[model samples]
Target chain A: MALDFTIIGYIAGTLTTFASLPQLIKSLKTKDMKGISPYFVMSFTTGLFLWLIYGLFRNDYPIIIFNIISLMFWIPLLYLSLMDNLKNKIKINIK
Target chain B: MALDFTIIGYIAGTLTTFASLPQLIKSLKTKDMKGISPYFVMSFTTGLFLWLIYGLFRNDYPIIIFNIISLMFWIPLLYLSLMDNLKNKIKINIK
Candidate 1:
């Protein structure tokens, strides 16, 4: 690949890493996972896992780096989602 | 690439595409775009565009297909976001 093309990949990866930040921020700020979909997050996280694996196999640093950031962004959301579910269950149990 | 590897790619793409569906649905249901981030969406969309282009350049069908579905999921969110912003602005202006 040309230097320019490689640079483009870097740019793309950077943009994607940044793109997921808002959801991360919102999830943090609101602590409300009500509307967020669990299935979607799981699937997206899985996809990122594959992307990370693919990056590793291909030895693509950009892919690896971007996915690392995405994982960081996603894990919290997933954890919060699970916690919300657990809390709801406890409420139901108490009721 | 091995057949197994190709299948993995297919599965990964399918999962990611499905993952984004819930957000699309929620965005549609609530029509609430307050928490969603425009910058993230813009950056993610740009990344998807590049992914599409990269897929085209490499003749990678999986990347292309996944991104198309992702685009479908994202564009509505983006539209809803813009519409909400406009609506809020109009309300403020009327006041």
Candidate 2:
């Protein structure tokens, strides 16, 4: 049987992109972003944004779709990370 | 000046793929995968494999390179999860 490679791309794209969700959920559940490194997230988000731009340039539907979904997940996590940092800063200032 | 989109792809690929390093290191340092979901890893691994296959079929070097690196981190993490589960099983059997 001939392999439909595009289907594989779709499945792979969805899995890798969505994998971040569990970590985001964990951070929310525990209200702890202690384990996640900001360096990784900042670099990862920048990379994803570039990928999204690339997708648009190529007009690749799957790339565009998946990259957008990834940004949706990552941006909020970044925001949470920022919020966490802000909280630390405020505590330090008060003390 | 015209933009070199390929460089953008490289940055994005490396960022997204290597983002797992911090998580992997955390697991190793703390010896805890309690926060990591096996379902996510399984699905993510499947996705990365397909992406690697797609890269090979398309002769896309960045895709191939990044996906392979991602698997490097993920496969070991998967093994750790399996080992953790096995240890849990042994504990139950002993009781």
Candidate 3:
């Protein structure tokens, strides 16, 4: 039963962690942050961070592993968002 | 103990379900699907669909509720992606 639980959790984590790839690719290819909300990413990342801490405290490797991967996925998005802001700033300044 | 588990699950679900808001807003505002990867959303939605099923089998209301809300979040994304495709098709057809 415990093994079943672990298997379930593992499968769930794997699929979700992998799911971020499409968005990551999209962001990378277009380099356009206009349609992606910074706030959503911000809140989601914050939520994931807390979940990571929870998983750590519980010694839940699956949760930790998944969130870590998610972190990798989100960090670039936030960075891209920042870059977009910078570009906009430059554009406005030029104007 | 069950109460505690329920509380934990609810908190987790609430935060996650709510996290989709920013992305929805961003998508609505920019109407630009270029930066968002359709494949990622597709896979993620598929994963969520399975999770919802699992939750249903387990009678896990939290999971069911969260995924249903997530469905709400993702459906729009998929729709937006389709619209973007349609627009592109029109553009190509015009050319």
Candidate 2 per-residue C-alpha lDDT over A1-95 given as tens digits, one digit per residue, 9 for 90 to 100:
12676677777788888887876777677767655566666777887888898778777888888999989988988888778878888999999
Candidate 2 deviant stretches above 4 angstroms: A1-3, A85-95, B1-3, B81-95
Worst 10 residues of 2 chain A by lDDT: A1-10
**Candidate 1 interface CA RMSD, Å:** 2.0
Please, what are the lDDT tens digits per residue for candidate 2 over residues B2-88? 266666666777788888787678666765655455666677787888899988887788889988998998888788767776787
- What's the ranking of the predictions by TM-score, best on top? 1, 3, 2
Model 2 whole-model lDDT (C-alpha atoms): 0.78
Candidate 1 lDDT by residue in tens digits, B1-95: 65655566577678767787888898789876676666766788888788777777667787778888888888777788778878989999999
In candidate 1 the C-alpha lDDT for residue A75 amounts to 85
DockQ score of the complex predicted as candidate 1: 0.58
State in Å the error of residue B67, model 1. 1.2
Candidate 2 docking quality: incorrect, acceptable, medium or high: medium
User: lDDT per prediction?
Assistant: 0.78, 0.78, 0.77
Task: Calculate DockQ per candidate and list them.
Answer: 0.58, 0.52, 0.48
Q: TM-score per candidate, in order?
A: 0.83, 0.79, 0.81
